[model samples]
Target: MTRWDAVRVRQGLVDSCCSAEQAGDQALRRGRPREARRHYERMLAEAIRLAEQFPDLSTRRDLTLAFNKYGAFWVGAHRLDQAAEAYAEGLAVATRLREENPDDIRLLRDLRFGEFTLGEIARQTGGPAGRRTAHDHCTTALALAEHLVGTDPHHTGDRRELGVVQERLGLLATERQELDEAAEWYARALSVRRELAAELPGDPRARRDLGVQYERLGDLALRRRDLEAARAHYDESLSLRRSLLGDDPRDLSTQRDLSVVCERLGDVALLTDGPEQARQWYDDSFAILDAAFGPKHPDTRTLRKKLRGHPVTPN
Candidate 1:
């Protein structure tokens, strides 16, 4: 084919596959899963074709990313088997690339994150047997997280990722009722996140990570029946989350997090304060969900159900 023909083919690939991917993203943000899936299916088909046709670094990288996102979508849709298959395929591609470029930062991050995501899927997979798989994935991810951070300790993103990895391990520990182990992991995560937040006070993501660490610690405190500690941690998270949305209360992501803080505070309120205060907090949380995602949304409906009862439970 001539140069012009080759250029035309490349443009066709962009218009066909990239455009589909973009449309999928937009549909996902709008909560149109069926529409998103249609677009993603097309994008995946094209991505596979592209990778098979040109097994170069860039095409292979795109293929890896395609599988990564497709797997994530399956996870959200509650298709565990498909999610695992897609993630495993992505990891295989990524592993080949990492072997080729041993010290490459991008590949290192990809492998680390891929492991972490796989751990999540494994944890949610076939009940008891999934636990061991989940733990192994998380352990490998944590090691990669440490290695990535060690490669560039000054890199803020890598440091933050280390904290996230620690937090994921902590979550698994909590589910296993290993409170002490969970606490240790959470403490480490909090330390790293706190330092990042303090160093980059202006960065919204840094503050948000610190806030999430506090939220998780607060959850642990609640599990231990340390009401006062839970309240204090929740308060700190609320403050930080509020700070992140100072002028943009409409920011759905921050608002959703803030809603969690509110619901947790509501739980504490049921114990410390009266039911009135607790109801108010729950209302605040539900209102955010109702407005952002509509009342018919799963989350909104769940919260609405909770609001129907006495609201004494700690859901």
Candidate 2:
């Protein structure tokens, strides 16, 4: 082909890749899963072709993004096998890129994300071996996040990433019933998240993230029978979550979070404030969760079990 023909072919390929990516992202934002899948699959195909035909660093990077998007789509769909395959493929490409450019911070961050996602999937799909493997992967991700935070302490994203990794470690410890270790890890994450929330007081997402840590800590306190401490944490979580839910009352996840915190507070009240106060809290939780998730849902069912012997009046 002539020089002009070659340039035209290259431009066409780039346009195809760009268009597909844009379409996929737009579809996802609009909650059109079928359209998103079609666009993402097309993007992946184009990326793969570009990677092979061009064999350049930029093309390979695009291919890596394609794999990551494909994996994330499958993960959201709960297709674990497909998610695993996509992640593995993307991770392999990321690993290669990391080897080629060890100092590339972008590649390092991508690797951490890939590893974290894979570990979470393993953790959710339980087995002794799978859990152990997940722990290892998450530990590696924590190390990477720590290093990144050390490199840029003022970077909010890096700090949040470190906090999340610490939280994951705490979860793993909790699963193993290592209460002391779990508490220590959670405390570290809580410190970071608290700082982040304070730094960005206007950001609801940051506050919500801190609230999550508080809720986890509350759960830990309950496990340790520290009723007062549990109440304090739950109260803090409830405050933040209420503010978040106030901004978007229709967000079912936020509503569910508020319900969980209220239920925990009721558990504390049951022990100290007697059945009347406890009953009020329990009823409030039941109302919220029953509305957000039907009475037959697991969350509502668990709430029912908790209220069984107590016999609270349903609203």
Candidate 3:
């Protein structure tokens, strides 16, 4: 193709990528995973075609953005392997762009996000190499986030991203049973999330992460037989999740978790009280489970059997 024709074709590809990304995002938000996948795949293919059709456009910021967006879609779809590949491509492009234009702050930020995502994927699928890779990438991303927070405290997105990285770090520490370290990380993340919530109460991601951190702490407390601590943390988690999710059927995961916590607390009550009070707690626990899982669910059936076997009497 002639030079002018090539430019037009590249622009067409860019437009196609943008359209695909928009469609993919909509599909994701609507919980249409299959449709989202199709859009993201199409965007990736178009990006590759553009790269081959016009080498000059391959490293352009727009093209890099397409890769990043596609990677985000893949991540949302739980296609972590594909997400990593897309992020790798985007990172390479961003690196080249940054080298050529050292003053491009946006490109630098994108590179950091790419690295953060890579770390997330690695952390989710653990082996020795995966753990090592996750640690390195998360450490690098953390340093970058810290720098951003220090230099630009008003940048809410940077602070939020820092909170996310800290939460992930907490998860890693928790997995290793480093309770103190995990608590420290989670506390920092919670602080950032609280700040973000104060500024933008409508944004729920930070709040959700905070709930998750609380639940993790509750699990640890339970393992140590710290019943009071576990109860407190689980209560906090349930309250937050209830506020954020309400009675939405899609939030059954959180609902089930809350029910489990209630059942555990009921067990504690059984040990401390006579049959009447114990039975009350057990009834409440069963009610929560039935509401969360429905009566026909396997969990409900199992809990029902347990309740029947225990046969709490009215004192």
Candidate 4:
């Protein structure tokens, strides 16, 4: 093609990408998944066309960004497989660009997020090899995020990302029955989130994460048969979650987790003290679960059955 023709194609591709991105943003803001997906797909196509027309470092970076945005959209839609594939493609492009321009911090951060997403996918799928890969990817992402934070301590985004990565790592460890390691990682993540919450008092995400970490720590303690520690963590988690989420439906998970912990604590009391104390604790747990999940919910039914001398599935 002639130089003018090539320039026109590149400009057209850029315009299409810009327009598609605006549409995608608007669709996402309006909570229209299908519309957002269409716009992002169009942007991805235009980005590929631009890369072909001008196969330069800058065009490659743009393509990477497009893929990253597409991946993010997929993630929001809960399409883990598609998100992983998009992130993988973006990572490859970003790695190549990073080799040419090593100082491009944004590319580096994108690569880290891609790796983190890949790790999350592997963890969700589950398997020994997948778990190992997830752990490795999380470790690398955490290190990268930590480095970013060290370079600029006020980089709240990086710090938040690091805390999330740590929390995921802790969860993976917990799944593998590595209670000690899980507790340690969860504590570290919780510390970072607490600091973040203090700095950005209005941000609910940080507070929510800290509450989740406390819940995880409580689970780990319970698994280790440390009733006192478990109770403390559970109480803290429940208090924090209640303060933040109140009685909103969004707090169901936290409510369920607290109920489980309460039930477990009752079991411990039964083994340690007398039946009366255990019954009181069990009743408290049952009341909470019944109120939040209703009498016919699995948890409430199981608890009721247990009280009636039937086999109950451990929470």
Question: lDDT scores for all predictions?
Answer: 0.88, 0.89, 0.77, 0.82
- Candidate 4 lands at a TM-score of 0.75
Model 4 superposed RMSD (Cα): 4.8
Worst 10 residues of 3 by lDDT: 54-63
Lowest-sum lDDT 10-residue window in model 4: 306-315
Q: Model 4, 1-315: lDDT tens per residue? A: 999998888888899999999999999999898999999999999999889878898788899889989988988888878988998899899888878888778877877887888898878768898899899889888887887788789988889998999989999998898877888899899899889988987776777777777777877887888878877887777677666656465677767766775676677677566676777777878888898889989889988888776233334
Best of the candidates, TM-score = 2
- Residues 1-315 of candidate 2 have per-residue lDDT tens digits of 888887787778889988998998899899998898899899899888888877777888778888988988888888887887898799899889989988888888888988888888889888887789789889989988988888888999989988998999898888888989999999999999999999998888888889999999999999899999999999999999999998899999999999989998999998888988998999899899999989999999988888876855554
| Clashing residue pairs for model 1 | none
- For model 2 the local lDDT of residue 213 reads 96
The worst-scoring run of ten residues by lDDT in candidate 2 lies at: 306-315
Off by over 4 Å in 3: 1-7, 19-39, 51-59, 68-79, 201-203, 245-315
What lDDT is obtained when candidate 4 is compared to the true structure? 0.82
Global lDDT for candidate 3?
0.77
Candidate 1 lDDT over 129-203, as tens digits, reads 787788898899889989988888899988998999899889888988999999999999999999999899889
Runs off by more than 4 Å, candidate 1:
1-16, 23-39, 273-280, 283-308, 311-315
Ranked by TM-score from best down, the candidates are: 2, 1, 4, 3
**lDDT by residue for model 3 over 213-294, one digit each (tens)?**
6777676677667777877887787677777666464677766766666666666556545556656666766787788778
lDDT of candidate 3 at residue 170, scale 0 to 100: 78
- The collision pairs in model 3 are none
Question: How far is each candidate from the true structure, as Cα RMSD in Å?
Answer: 3.6, 2.6, 4.7, 4.8
Residue 120 alpha-carbon offset, candidate 2, angstroms: 0.6
